[model samples]
Target: MKAVLIEADTISSAWSQLIYEIYKNGEEHKPDYSMSTRRLHATVAINDVDNNQINSFVPFGENLIKKYKEELTEEYAEWYISLPDDDKRKFDYCYAKQLFRYGETAYNTLSENLKNLRVGSRRHVGVLWENEVHIPKFEDQPCWIAYKLELLNETDVLLYILYRSWDAYGGFPANLPAIVEGFKKVFREKKLPYRIESLIATGWDTHIYESDLQAVEKIFKIAQLCPKCGNLTPKHALISTTKGKVCTQCKCRM
Candidate 1:
């Protein structure tokens, strides 16, 4: 499998390029573990973590993005406390639970790591998967596996994330922003002086599922020509609204 590398100034751009590259270059494959998909191995670097919104022609909207981010930043225990015992055990492996509450005591991995960094502990990595917990499961396993924070030159912090698998069409837009929000929450709480320099994400199986092929086609069709500017642009570079579609460059509405 060829590894594709994408470097963009924002998450929106990275996701846009990623989906287009997969649509253009990926090969169709049926994995034993999951649904058939057009798959690629990809590494994406977003230079500005703050510019993480998906202002594109994707299916989902900001509400879904906000929910995903809340799952990362909010405390799982607080939410879990309201759930019945059976319900809690059945839905045990959300990103929130794994991230904010891992292991027997529900150790807060992000908080612990931030605290370590504050006191000058060299460890900045957080593990989201446990072999004992996740290895036996074929379903409900986390696509996201781990994350690391790298402090560079005492000025900026770069976040590196790893995913066992990623759904390029349905998952990428929401996931990236959520991860960045999670880290920003920690940085703010810890009162870290460093800015988030970039976000580097690697996915072993970055893919668009067969079910989403039609939607991908629609996105490409919409991107072919800006209705207002009449210039060719990718869908990610344009913003769609109920009133009209707007070109990012010319800001013309149609």
Candidate 2:
């Protein structure tokens, strides 16, 4: 587990810098920096309450940095991250930064998802998802799913799952939470874990909009980083074009 304590000028700037750092370093290369979550990006983030600024930090699986630390601004408050490799690039970044779980750092959102789902074996399953957040505050919809679990010989743990009923880029926030909460409720009643051995996601494409970039920034600014966990932030400034934002660091699309 690696950790980086990050400070930002307006919190937004800090997070933006952090996200750019991670996007550059992830395993997969996203040519379209603006659209790809795999690439560096920033979102609204929050640091400890003392000072309010966008909070963004990246984590490394291995000891990528040993005794590495620095203050970006002159007051030593905040600025874009900088490493020894270059004068312009910041070194901190990750694709998925696990924030907090049970007072400890989490690995990925999927990790907890697997835990709650309990990896059950099902003969068949169906998943329907609508992932858009309406601007006018429209009526809410729910995704429908069907599941049949074979328990022992005769007993069965049956369930239906939905990641999000609405259509939005940030579906994971609402959908993942719903799934976890549902799992908790079912686990209490059934006693046996609601095992979801298989999942059948509908043919869908999850994407980020240039218009929603600001919303993403605000989210990261408010989003808290889990201690000892990688907090991948998004880019602070992104103008949506058919062409994706290119990483100044890696010379790849962010």
Measured with C-alpha atoms, the lDDT of residue 69 in candidate 1 is: 85
- The weakest ten consecutive residues by lDDT in model 2 span 94-103
Q: What is the lDDT of residue 191 in candidate 2?
A: 62
Off by over 4 Å in 2: 1-120, 124-168, 193-203, 217-230, 233-254
10 residues in a row with least lDDT, candidate 1: 224-233
Local accuracy of candidate 1 as per-residue lDDT tens digits, 208-230 = 99989888887788685445533
| Most accurate candidate by lDDT | 1
The sequence of per-residue lDDT tens digits that candidate 2 reaches over residues 1-254 is 12233343232233443443432342233333333333222222223212322123322211222112112111111133113436544433211111111112222222233344433454433222213322342433232222223332223233333222222333322332233334334444456544432222220222233454566556566443322222332344333344543223223233
* Candidate 1 CA-lDDT value: 0.78
Error of 1 at 232 (Å): 9.5
Q: Give Cα-based local distance difference scores for all models.
A: 0.78, 0.31
Compared to the true structure, candidate 2 yields what TM-score?
A: 0.29
Error of 1 at 235 (Å): 7.9
